[model samples]
Every structure is written in C-alpha cells, then in structure tokens.
Target: MSDDLIPGDESSAADAADAVYRELLERLGEAQPQPRLGATKRALELLGNPESSFAIIQIAGTNGKTSTARMIESILRAHGLRTGLFTSPHLVRFTERIGIDGERISDEAVARNWDDIKPYLAMVDAELTAAGEPALTFFEALTVLGFACFGDAPVDVAVVEVGMGGAWDSTNAADAEVAVFTPIDLDHVQRLGKTIAEIARTKAGIIKPGAQVVSAAQHPDARQAIVDAAAAVDDPAVFEGEEFALVQDAVAVGGQLITVRGRAGTYPELYLPLYGDHQGRNATLAIAAVEAFLGGATQPIAEDVLAEGLTEVASPGRLQLIGTEPTVLVDAAHNPHGAASLVAALGSYFDVDEIAFVVGILQDKDAAGILTTLAPAASGFFFTQSESERAIPAEELSRLAASLDLPASTFADTLDEAAEDARRWAEEAPRRLVVITGSITLVGEAIEVADDREWKATA
Candidate 1:
C-alpha cells in the first residue's frame, strides 16, 4: 500500500482507534438499546461523572436528530463556546461520532480516552453480571467514552444525539439542560413501541424536571405526549408552528434561503447550505434550542453570530453530492418520512427526472414504506447491502422491489460497484441522477468508496 493511503504514525493511530471500535462491537450492538441507564450511570459514577462536567443539549426523535444536533453545536461554537458534539452512525470513521469544535475527535484522542475508561467500564460490567443483568451495550459504553472524551477536553458545552428512543438511551444519563425533539414518527417500532404516540412518549423522557424543551412540528399524538411530559415537570415546551417556526424558505444556489420566527426573535434572510425544507425546520429548531440554552429564549442571539453559524452549517449524507458527470447523491434517509423529504428535495433542488437509486435497508426497517415512498420518483432500483450484518440482502430487496412492480437492477459484490452501474445508467440520459439511500450504514460505506475513487463534484 502507498504511504498516501496509510502514513506511518498517523496510520498507526487510526488503526488503534479502529481497534477501540472493534472492542466496542464485541459488546451487544446498538440495534437493540437496553431499556435501562443504570449500567451507564454506574460506569460514569466510577469515572467521577464526566457527563456532568459540561453543559449538555440532548436531541431525540425518529428523524433529523443528528442534523439538528450539529446545527446547535455549530451555533454554540460560533458564540465562542468550546463545543463537544456527539452524533450517531458515523458516515465515515467512528471518530466522526464525537467532535471537538466542529472537527472529528482525533484518532489519538479516541484511543487514549478509551484506554482510560476501560477499567471503570469493566467494574460496571462485573456488577451487572453479579446482579443477573446484561452488561452495557455498544451505545451505552460509547456514550460514556464520548462524554469522558468531552469532559477531558473541558468543553464549554456538549451537543449529543440520542442513539435511539430517548427514555433509556444511554445518553439520557447526562441530564441535558435542554431537551430538543425533532419530528417523531414510526421508527424502531419493535424496541420503542407500535404507534407514534408510544414512540413520542418514549422520546419525551429526555425532558427532565428543569430542562428547557424545544421541539419541531410533530403529529398531534406526538405533540400531546411531549406536552404532557413537559407539564409533569412544570416546563412549558416551545414548539414550531406555535412559538417558533420556519417562516420562509426559498431555493437558492447550492442551498436555500430561510427566515425563522424564533421564540425570542425573528431571524430573516439566512443562507443555510443544506437541502430540503425539512432542514429549514431543523435549523429553526436548532436556533430555538440555542436560544433556550444561552438565555432561556428570552434574549435574541446576535445577528452576526447566527448568520455565521447558519452559513457554515453542513448536514452530510443528507442530499450530499458525491460525484458529477453522472451525478451521484447520498442521503441517509432510512425511514418513510426521510424518504419523502429526499423526494421533495430532489424535485425542488435539482432538475432531475428519473433516479436510479442504489438502495439498502436494514433487517428490521420499514422497507415497504420507504421503497413505496421512493417508487413514484424512481426509474429503477439497484439493490445492494452494506458491510453491516443487519443489512437486508440485495436478492431479498430485489424480490421486494419486483413485488412492488418497481424495476430492479442486478446485484453487485459491493456498494461501490452498484453505485458505478447506477451512475453509468444515469449518464446515458439527460436530467437523470443516481442516489444512494435507505440506510446510514450504506451511506457511510458509499462515502468511503467515493473518497477512495475520488468522485469529485464539478457542480
């Protein structure tokens, strides 16, 4: 291998970080989050409760949680706060899940922190075993490690995205000062609950006794659940379409222009370089979240700070263009709601008619709902799978697609090959594009493939 691919010392650090991730995988995966935080809290307590060392803003929802968390982190950083951001299901490296000041936490940092926390975690594991309970799952351990990393960095604030439904997700142990909810819908039905109300109620558990609550527009059932949760704590949750809203948004070059009516003030004429009208709502929710965090939504953020934050905001793997001359876009739109937003963004942001989607869905996801949502705008489907063991097989996906009367393409040994074939088909016609979607795991693998192949975007 060339030194360009793996330089001596730097490559060693990355390999070490990868080793840390592998050790985490040896535990139970995040597919089934444990319904209790006692294990996580016990581990943290042994480490002096590092999560309590910094102020936290925790986000929970079925969709847009990671994007909204990034926005809040960026704005807080723009305001001169040393910020720590933790999002889920990294699109490239495990380090991407934890960030210090908008940059991925370094490989060396991840390795060092994991080493420091291993002993404390082992103690917690023994305690759980003795009590006849399961040890901490992958996400639970990772949350502890992430918070320890942030506390050691001594950040001014930390923005965290829940790994799953909020109530018992390990990050909930942090007791975030601001509880932010993105749109809640049917997701993780097996683990969370069967209906939207059940899921939303599970999510609202992040709202503690005195935490400020900020929410995006939600289904009536979802909204009521959050309202009830907040009232129980004597906290009035500020919501979009009510106290705050995405007042205006128009398609702009490379992104969109937006105006938001926040609880404390009105932010007009903002340039947010993220696709979808959904992103505009995510931005408004983020603004309100920061408002509540800094000054209880009673003082407006300075216009320049807000402008800088929005201008620099980025939501990768969400309508992100990875190539040109054929036009390949990757979006982590695994569920029906996110799929609907992707279709809308394509209609509004780009001049594409037919899309050949290189798709892969997880084992337990709502494949029918997601594919059905995309079927109306799709020309063909290139069924594929990621390295994730949870990914549904390409042949199985092909069978599902055929049953839906959607055209299916041949499978490939790898996602990169599938994307290449889809892009080739797209390049043969005018105003056609290739989209890679359905799972974050697939998008993450596609990103690595894109980087390796140097798929530069001319547009």
Candidate 2:
C-alpha cells in the first residue's frame, strides 16, 4: 500500500489513533471482567497467535510487576535483543502500555495496528456472541493488540505484566517461558481472594509446565502455594532470599547501590537509579529472572551490560521525585504494604523534617490501613480523589483520617489543587517535603501538574 493511500494523513494520525483508543475505552463501560483465557485465546488465534512468535516472560504479583517487567526488558535489550514490553495501568499515554525496543509504540503504529487487527477483533466478537458470551473486554482486546504489535515488531523477547490475577488473565493466553512473581499481598481481595494463600494460589497459576519460575520471598502461606504450584508443574522455582538475594544496598545520591547474589553468580556494586529497598529487592529479582531466562541459573550476564541496564531502568509514579526546593515526590502506594514501603523509603533517602501528603485512594482499598501505615512519617494530609470513578471522595478520606487521629485537610476538588495545597504547606518550611500518593492515577495527575507548572527539581 502506498503511503498516500493509508487510512489517514500523518498530521491526522494522532486524532485517528485517539478515536480508536476511545472505542477501547467504551468497552470499559461494561466493567464486566471476563476473567478467562477463552476470549483472548480466540482473539490471538485469529491474529495467527502472535504471542507465541516471540519468547515470553510473564510477571505477576500485587505490586512491582511493572517495575520488574521494565527491568527485565531493559536487561534483555542491553544484551543485544529486540524486546517488547506490555505493562498495565499506564501513568500517562495509552501507548505507554506497549513498548518495542525500549520505547513506547508510536501513535502512528497504534493506529495502523488497530486498523490491521480490527477485522480479526470483530470476528472474535461474533464468535463470542454466538457462544452466548460477552464480547472481548478492554483488557482482553488490548492484550490481543499488544501481541499482534509484538509479532509485527518481530521482537526477540516479550516481557508481559499481568493486569490482575494470573490465572485466566487475558495475557495468560500466552504460555511464558519464564514466570516471575513479586510479593503477593491482600489488595485485590474482591477479585483474587480474601486471604494471602488464596491470592498466592491465583497468582501461581502463571507458572506453566516446564517453565522456570522466579519469585520473591513471601509469607509462609504464599511461599507454600508457589512451591506447590511449581511442584505440580514440574518446574524449577527460585525464590529471593533463598536461591538469589539482594546482598547489600545503600542509599546513593540519586538512587541506590546494591549487590545481588544471582542464581548464576554474584553481581556487585550495581547502581540502580531508583529509590527504596523494595526496589533493590526488585532489581535482584529482575537480575535473577533474566539469568533464568537466558540460561538455567548457571550462566552469568556480562557485568557491564547488567550495570548499563540497571542504570537505564525507570519506574515512574513509584517514589519518583518530580520537583525540589520544597521537594515534591509522587508514589503509587495504594495499599498498606505499598504505603509502608513509601514511608520507609522517604525516611531512609530524603532529609525532610516533615512531609505533607496529597493522598487519594480507590473506594475498594483500605484507606484506614494506608493512613495508619503512613502516619509515622506524615506530618499533615491533603485528601483528594483521582479521576477514576472508583476513587473515594476527598471528604470521605478526610473523615477516615480524622477517625484515625491523623491531621487532615480535604481538597474535595482536583488532584492539582491537592498537590498545590501540599506544595504550599511544604513551602512554609525550609526542609519540608510534599508527597502525592495513595493512587497511581493521582500520582500521574501530580506529574502532569508539575510538568505544566515547570516544577523542576532544584536539589
């Protein structure tokens, strides 16, 4: 096909792409999660099973999935491989979820690929309707689109992050060669399960027969579930702090320095340009996962390549510093465990005497649990809600904080107002900090507001 004969002109491609994205958003209005592999499987089969064309690594857990997936993609790309990365709940652009060769897929590519797959998607919709099943969901369609894009890119490997629980998640349509699990917690109790063991069992479903499984140290119940799952599949399983470990970590200027005892060999003095000890642990898991993927825990990656990959790793909306001089940091800490990690990282890394938090949370999350975890480090709170329909109202959050005996104020407006209020509170003192957190959507909004206000880090 000639360039002139394309569906839209170059200047109009963005609008065309956005229209396609809007159609995908319309699928979310139903919100009826078809948590099964059937829809995605059928869709991919129609697309010629592009997911199987490339080597796949699947990462699943309550948190750190996106960060670990990014790390794995970066390390694999550093090793001179073309890598495709599919992550969920993008901070900004829809295109952020799909990456090829270390960069997000372009809007033009999104438009072109959607056009190419539209017919096959329609076919799947018809098939599902005939079977008295609902059509493909927003996530299911997106998963199929990502696989098709990866196949078109002809990437050597693809790092895929599960959107939710691993078993029957849309991405599970692809059998991964490597299955990685981060810490499993009690966040998504309504969908996954109510207990740690139940959640771990749901997550362990990602481990396929003959696939290598790498996991973080877990609670006893969670650990047993993973071990049992691996045993059932006859797969080799490596757990952090046992098979591989983060040997040492110290706070550095911009981020942290760590040494990892990988399954293959001990890697020392790796500079990870991200904060938090949890991140250091995540880096160790990423290294071990890469080691497992390349070879079975015995072959070592080149030191320089590993270092370069770690240096280039970026996990935005996760304790990301957006501004300084009355410093502003944004973290997507929606649950108690994540909130505790945020508070710990703040205490260990930054020198702020006090912190004012701009907090927003989803309706289903444990607001009291999060506030309690954050209470130790928080000097004040600015409660707000993100754009998500599921977010709790700011006044409700403020009331919850009051019950918890935490000093709180309510923005009851936009996240921008909450962020600015927090910033003003921080500006009153020389070494005060403003932290925008509690939800990923809130952190994303804070970042956008910071960018618009030209708020650069002055430190």
Candidate 3:
C-alpha cells in the first residue's frame, strides 16, 4: 500500500473534514441514545475537560431552547465577547450545532479539532467498553466535540441548549453558571416524564449550586417543581412574571415591538425582528439570563448593545417567512404546545384570509393535538413527511387530520412536491398563505427546497 493509504495521509482540509464527518455519521447510526451522563463526562474527562475552560449558560425547555439560546448568544456577542453556541438537531448541516463568534465552525476547524481529539475519544470509548457501558452516543460525542472546539476557540462564554432532559443530557456535563428554562411543557414524555411537573423537575436539574436560575412564567405545578429544585440548591431563582416580563408588545412591520421589565430596569420599544408574542417572551428571557450572567439584575446591558443584539438576532424555522408573492412560511412546531404558539402567531401577525398548511410529524409526537391546535388557522392541509425514519406516513397524518374535521390531503412523496401543491392552492385563493410546519425535520427539508427554488425573499 502507498504511503497515502495510511490514516495520516496528505488529505486536503475539506477531505479530512469529510472523512471525520463520515465517521461521525457511522457513530450516529450506531447510537443507542442511552440518556446517561457517564459516557459524556468520561469523554470530557479524557479530553482534559475542555468544557470547564469557559463559563457556560445552559438553556433547557420543551420548545424554545434553541431560539432562546440563539438570542442569548447574539446578545452576548453584541457585548463584544467571543461567544460559542452549541445547539442540537441542526436543521440542515451538522456544523450548525457549534458556532463561534456568530459563525458556524469552519470545516477545517472541525477536521483539525476532530483529528486532535480522536485519540482521546477512542480512549474514552475503550474505557466505557471495559466498564460494560455502551460507547458514547451521537449527541454525547458531539457534545464533547463542541466543548473541544469552543476550548480551542478560547471563547469567553458558551451558550448551550440541552438536547433532551437537562439533568442527564450529554451537554449537562458542563457546569452551567446560569441555567435558563423557557416555558417547559409536556414533551418527550416517554423519556422526560408524563406530566408537566415531572418534565419541569427533570429540566430543573441543570441548576448548579449558587447558579443564577432564570425561568419563564410556568404552570403552577411546573413552577413549584423548579422553585423547589432551586431552593434545594440554595440558588437564586428568577421567574418571568414576578421578576421580569414583556411589559408591552405590538405586532410590528417585519416583526414585533415590545417593552421588557427586566430584573433591574425596564427597556421599552425594543424591536425584535421575529414574530409572535412567544418570541417576545423568549427575547425577554434571554435578556434576563444575560443580565444574570453578566451581573445580577441590577447591572443592565448597555441600551445600544441590547438594541443591536435584538435587531441582529434571527431564529430560522421558527415562524420564518421564506418566500413571497404567494407568501410561504415555515415553522418547526412539532408538539401541541409549540403548535398552539404557532397558531397564535399566525393569527396575530399575518392578515391572510386562509392558510394552506403542509404538515409532517414524527411518529412519537401528538399529531392529533398539533392538528387540533392549528385547525382553526388552516384552510386546507397537505400531509407529508420529512426524510426521517420516525416520520409518520402521510396517509396516516391525513387520516388524523380528517378525524379532527380538518380539510386534509396527502402528499406522500416529497416536501418539494407538497410545497408546490400548497403554493398552488394558496395562489388559487387571494390573500392566502402557504405554511410548511409540524416537524423540525420537515421545516429543514422545506427550507432546503425553498433555497433551491430561490423562493427565499431577501430582506
């Protein structure tokens, strides 16, 4: 065999990145998803515990974790600090999970880091194997990789969104300085818990001793659970309604204008370039978390910095409008709670008379509940699935919609076809909208299709 055939061959950076990504995919395919912390903690330990090199803000919740995390990262970066963001379930590319200074990690960086850490990862894998535990899952490995990348970047702060329940999640291995919860509800019941209280309790585990815990206004039971958790740890807990709130919000052109009452002071007329009162609340929570992280509520961020941060922030696939003419929007609202938020946003933001919804949901989600919540806003439905193994069949989803007395049609083929059909239906009726939603995977696929068709309108 030639020298080039050796593992340390003279491959281009892109080629090396591709090789590393392929190996990651292989590991991802074999992932067993054992929701435990041992594997990840061990891996981090083997890698010299890169997660401890920087301060961390861990955001956990059912629906808005990613959006909130993104907002926090943007705000912190606006403060002129080098920030690292680690979020899960990337919409299109794996690189989306790790960002430094508001940019996705470069392929060369990923490859270089992976190459540097491969031996350590292998050592951890062998240790786990010898201990009779399964190897690190996809998320676990990715979490370690993200921490390593962030350490190599030498970021001042890292904003992390929990992949699953906060306590045992792979990312939880990092001791977060600030733990933020955004409107926890019933989600991942099979893994988290069956009740809102149970889920909140699981999420509240992210609260470390002396950590400043920030939570959105939650249901009474959920609130109690989080409060109890914080009390147990002797941490200072701040709740939205009691400590901070969206004082005023109005639908604005492009997005929404709002006033927020933070722990220290009130900021008014902040324009967040994102739709929905829910998003407004998310922004408030992010602001509060950042305040707590930088200083307690008494220290407010510079007014100019806060305004620039909110203005520059963007949450793609969360009530995002990707097209015009016959307006096409996409949202990743898979659960009933998220669906309710989507429905509210649709009613409050857009003036369309009707909406043709192209929905695809995972098998585990409450498809009926989602359809029920969205039924009032939808004129018709085109049921489709994403390129996910867990996606429910289009016919099955249509049947579910029909049972709810919703007008439904099946597009079992592809998101592109489903979108085209929805667009045509919307065009047939003036002032109508076309929406692709229900599953994040579906929204990601639809976004790809929209980009390919040049359907995305420039701002």
Query: Per-residue alpha-carbon lDDT of model 3 for 124-233, expressed as tens digits?
Result: 88987899877777778888889999999989999999988888988889999999999988888888899998999889989889799999999998899889999998
2 versus 3: better lDDT goes to: 2
For candidate 1, write residues 408-432 as lDDT tens digits.
Answer: 5667757977888897898788989
Q: Local error of candidate 2 at 139, Å?
A: 0.1
Per-model TM-score, in order, reads 0.96, 0.97, 0.95
The RMSD of every model to the true structure, in order and in angstroms, is 3.0, 1.9, 2.9
Ranking the candidates on TM-score from highest down gives 2, 1, 3
Model 1's TM-score against the true structure = 0.96
Q: Considering every candidate listed, which one attains the maximal lDDT?
A: 1
> lDDT score, residue 27, model 2?
79
Give candidate 2's TM-score.
Answer: 0.97
Give, for candidate 3, the lowest lDDT window spanning 10 residues: 1-10
Question: What lDDT score goes with residue 235 in model 1?
Answer: 87
